[model samples]
Target: MGNIQVALMTVLMFFLLVSLHEWGHYYFARRAGILVREFAIGFGPKLFSIKRGETRYTLRLLPIGGFVRMAGEDPEVVEVQPGQTLAVRVKDNAVTRIYLDRLDERSGVMRGEVKALDLERDLFIQLDVDGEIERYAVHPQALIIARGRDTQIAPIDRQFGHKPVGKRALAIFAGPVMNFLLAFVLFGLALLLQGVPSETSSKVFISGVVPDSIAEQAGVEKDDLVKSINGVVIGGNYEKFVEIINSSAGKQISLVVERKGEDVALKMTPDATTGKIGIYPAGEYRKPSAGETLTYAATSMKDWTGRIFEGFRKLIFGEFKLDDLGGPVKTTQVTVEIAKQGLAQLTSWAAVLSLYLGIFNLLPIPALDGSRLLFLGIEAVRGRPIDPNRESMVHLVGFAMLMLLMIVVTYNDIIGLVRN
Candidate 1:
C-alpha cells in the first residue's frame, strides 16, 4: 500500500515536471505572436482534452513524452470537399479522365491528380506523386499530399516561420530553459525550507568496515572516530587523513582512533589492491544562510550540469553501460524511493531531474529543441529556410530513431527489474 502511494506520487511529480517543460515552449511561442495549436501533455492517442482560445490541451496515453504543436510548424495544406459521394456520370459507359483532389497522407494536403475514372467501379482516380501513385477518395475528408508549388494555408502572422529568427529560436529553446529554471526554483525552495547550515564538521569516523579488509583484519570497528594516522593528527582535515591512508599502500601504518572516549592504537599493512580502502568517511550535510542559498544554488546548478556532461561523455566512451541508463521504469522506482525518504529529498530529486531534462533537450539531436534551433540557424545563414518538407522528413526520421532508443532502454529497465 505504501509502495503504491509512493509510486503514484513519483509519477505525478514526473508528469508535472514534463508538462512544465512543454509549457515553456507554449508560453514562449504565444509570447512571440505565433499561434500554438495544441499543448499536449503526452504522446500517442489522447485520452482527454480541453480546448480554449485556439489551443487544445491534451492528456495522452503515454506518460513519458509531450509536445507543443505550433501553427504551420510543418508543411500543411487543408482542403475540404465535404459531401456525400456518388458515382461519376459516365459518357457512353467509357472510362473518363478527370482531375480530383484528396488528402495526401504525407503532406496532409489535398492535391490535384489526373486519374482514369472507371465511373463504374472504384469511381476513383490515381495520381502519381513523387514516383508513388496516390489514390484519392471521392468522399469527404479525402486529403492528399500537396503536389508542386508551395500552398501554405495558414496566415503569415500565425505561421511559425513568419516569426523573426530570434523569436523562433527562443520559442524552441524555451522548453529546456524552463527545465533549468524549474530545477533552480525547486533547489532554492528546498534549501529555504531546510534552512542554511552555519557550521562545518570534519571529524573522521568509520561508518562501516568491509569484511576481510585490512581495517577489519586489524580489528577496526565501525563508529571509531579517527584522531590521527602515523602520528599525524588530521587537525580537522579528514580528507588529508584519507589521502595518507591511500598513499601508504603496501606499507605498515599506525592507526589512531578514539574508541568510546579512549585512544586506541592499531597497526596493519596496507593492502596492495587498487582502490584499497575498505573504510569510508561518514558524509556531512548542512545548510547555509539565505544569501548563501542563492550562491549555493548557482554553484550547485553549475556543478550538477557539469556532472551531467561528464556522465554523457563517459557513456559515449563506453565507461557506462546501456543498462546503467534509466528509463521511465527506473525513474518510477527511484521516484518512489526518494518520495519515501521525505519532501526534502523529493524536491532535490525533482531539481536534478529538471536539470537533466534541460541539458538533454538542448542536445543537438533531431526532433529536439536543439535540432529545431539548428534548422533555424541554417535558415539564418542561408538567408532562406530549408524546404519544410525536407526539414519535416529529417525530424520524422530522427523521431523514429529516438523512439527505437527509448524502446531499447525501456526493455533493459524491465529486464533489470525482473532480475532484481
Candidate 2:
C-alpha cells in the first residue's frame, strides 16, 4: 500500500479500538436502564450525528478517543412554570396543526390514526411523522422543545446514580472488560489467519532477535541453541524460561549456548526494566484447529495480564523506572511501523495495544475509569457516596497532570523518531 493508504488504515484501526471501548460502556449503561444522552465515536467538534430514540449517535472530528455520556453527569433540574409555551411537534409537517395545549394529564389525545402512547406520566409518545410512527420520550421536567432537540432529560426513574452499587460498578467496569475481549478477538483472528506454532518450538533455539537487543549484542544468532542461563540448566517449560529472563532484568547473567555442537559461554545484561533480550523463541508454523485458536487467544490474554501485574509488582519494589513508560505518540509510531508488516503482524500488535489499554484503565489514577471504580468501591464499603465536589476536584487535578505528562512523552517520541 502507498504511504497515504497506510496512514488511513492505521487511523481507522485506532478509531475502531476507541469505538469498541466506548460501546462497552454504552451497552452496559443501557442494559441497567441508565440514560445515555449521547453515543459518540470521537472527540472534538461534531462531524455528523443521527438521533434514534433517547440517544444521539455522533461522529466527531478527533479520531483518537470517544465517549458515552450518561445521565448522572448532568442530571436534569426540572421545575414546572405555568404559562410556559413549549413547542411540541406531534407531526413532521408543521402546517398540519398540532399544538402543546392539546397535551394534558386527562384522557390522552387519541388523534387520527393514533400509534403508541406511554400512559404512565405520558412520558413516551409516538405519532405518525410522514407514514412513520416517530417515538419521543418527554422528561416530566422540561417542556420547551426546539426543532431537533430532546426537551426531556433522562427520567429520574432510570438515572445512573439511583442504581445499586453493583449495577453501577458493572457499568463502569464494562469498558475495560470489552477492551480485553477486543484483544482476544484480534489474537484469535491472527492465529486463524497465520497458523499456530509448530511442534519444533519445544526445542530451545532463537528464531529472531530485536535490533540492538541484549541477545543480539551477546552474539546470540538465529537457530543457536540455548543450553543454559546463568549457571542453571535450560528447562523444557517455556513459561519458566520466560519468567527467569524477565525477572533477571537489570542483572548480569552468564549464558551457555550450543552453536552447531560447540558450547559457547556468553555474558549479557537484560533491559533494566523489561528484562527483554529482544529475541523471539523459535516456532514452526502449522494449521490451527478451532479449539487451538480459542486456546491461543485465551492464553494470550492471560499472559498479557500477568505481565502487567508483574510490572506493577516490580515498580512497587523500585525495580522498575518511569522512563520505561510510553505515551500515545510512541504507540502511534508503533502502529505505523507494525502496519508495514503483514496483516497477521498488525493484528498481533493491535492485540497487545488493546491489552495494555485495558490494563492501564484499571490503575487507580484520577480522570480514569479505574478512579471511578475506586470511588464506587469506597461507596460500597461506606454505604454512602463520596462528596461530589471533592471527587470532581480530584479528577480535574489528575487530568491536568496527565496532560502535562503527555506533552513530555510526545516530545520524547518526536526526538526518538528523528534519531531513528
Candidate 3:
C-alpha cells in the first residue's frame, strides 16, 4: 500500500474504535435517564453536526479523540439576570423555547425582561412585560437558544451526577467493555478469514519458497518433503530446523528432500541479516470448524490480554525503557508496516490495538473511566458523593499531566522514526 492509503486506513481504524468506545458511554447514559447533550467524534472545530432527539451528533476536524458529553457532568450553570430581556415561546401554557437573541418574526414569541427563573427545580420563568409581572411554567423539553445554537434544558433528575451510583458506574465502565468486545469480534473475524493453524507431525512438507530467496535459488520446490538437514534428521520438528538454519546464517547447509518418492539434494545459505531461507511449511493450516474458531478466538484474545498486561506491569515496575513506550505517531508507523502484509495481518494488528486501547483506558489514571469508577467506589463506601468541584479539579490536573506526557511521547516517536 502507498503511504497515503496506509494513512487513511489508520485514521479510519482510529475513528471506528473511538466511536464505538464513546457510543458505549452514550448508550448507557441514556439508559440511565441521563441527558446526553453532545455525542462528538474528534475535537477542535466542528466539521459536521446534526441534532438527533435530545443529543447533537458532531464530527470534528481532529480524528485523534472523541467524547460523550452528559449533562451535569460539567460545572455549567444557566443564569438569566432579573433585568435581562428575552423572548419566550409558550406552548400549552409552558415556555417551550427561550431565545436570547432578539425576537424573530415568530408571532407567538413573548418579549419581556426576566424577573426570576427556576430552570432546575420548578421549571418556571417569571418575566416583566409592559410593567406587568407574570410567571409561566417551563416545559421539561424546552429548547434554550443562544447565538443560533440550541440545547435542550437538563433538569436535576435528568443530570448525570444525580443518577444512582450503580448506574453512573456502569455508564463509566461501559466504554472499555465495548473495546474488549470489539477486539474479540475482530479477532474472530480475522481467524475466520485466515485459516487456523493445524497440528504438524513428524514430517515437514514444503508449501512454497519465498521469491528470490536462498531456498528458491537452491531449487527447493513446493511439495518437497524435507528428509534431513545438514545430515541431522529434522523429524518434522520445525523449531529444530529453524534452530539449525539460524545457527548457520551466511553458511551453506545440506538439505535432503523427498520429491515424488526420490531423494533430492540441495544446498543453500540463510540470509545473513534474518537467518531465514524463506521456505513456507505445508500442513500448517486447516479450515477451522465453528466450535474451533470460537475456541481459538477466545484463546487468542486471552493471550493478547495477558501479554498487554505484562507490558503494563513492566512499565509500572521500571523494567521497560523509555524507548519501549509508543504514542500515536509510533502507532501509525507500525500500522503502515502492517498494512503491507495483507488484510488478514492488518485485521489481527487492529484487534491487538483495540485490546490495548481497552486495557489502557481501564488503568486507574485520573481523567479516565477507571478514575471515575474509583470516585464512585469512594462514594459508595462513604455513603455520600465527593464534592464535584474537587473531583473536577483532580481530573483537570490529571488531564494536563496526560497531555504533557503525550507531547513527550510523540516527540520521542518522531525522533525515533527519523533515526530509522
State each model's C-alpha RMSD to the native. Answer: 11.8, 10.4, 4.8
RMSD to the native, candidate 3? 4.8
Residue range 319-385, candidate 2, lDDT tens digits: 9666566667788877887776556777888888788878888899998889989999999999999
Deviating ranges (above 4 Å) for candidate 3: 1-8, 104-107, 198-248, 252-268, 271-275, 278-284
Query: Which lDDT value does model 1 have at 195?
Result: 53
Lowest-scoring 10 consecutive residues by lDDT in candidate 1? 82-91
**What is the TM-score (0 to 1) of candidate 3?**
0.84
- For candidate 1, what is the total of clashing residue pairs? 13
- How far out, in Å, is residue 135 in model 3? 1.7
lDDT of 2 at 219: 89
- What tens digits encode model 1's per-residue C-alpha lDDT throughout 32-106? 878787889878998998877667789999888799988778755433242322122123432222223333232
Q: Report lDDT (Cα) of residue 347, candidate 2.
A: 84
Q: After superposition, how far is residue 190 of candidate 3 from its true place, in Å?
A: 1.8
- Tell me, by TM-score, which candidate is best: 3
For residue 147, model 3's alpha carbon misses the true position, in angstroms, by 2.0
- TM-score of the candidate numbered 2? 0.64
Ranking by lDDT: 3, 1, 2
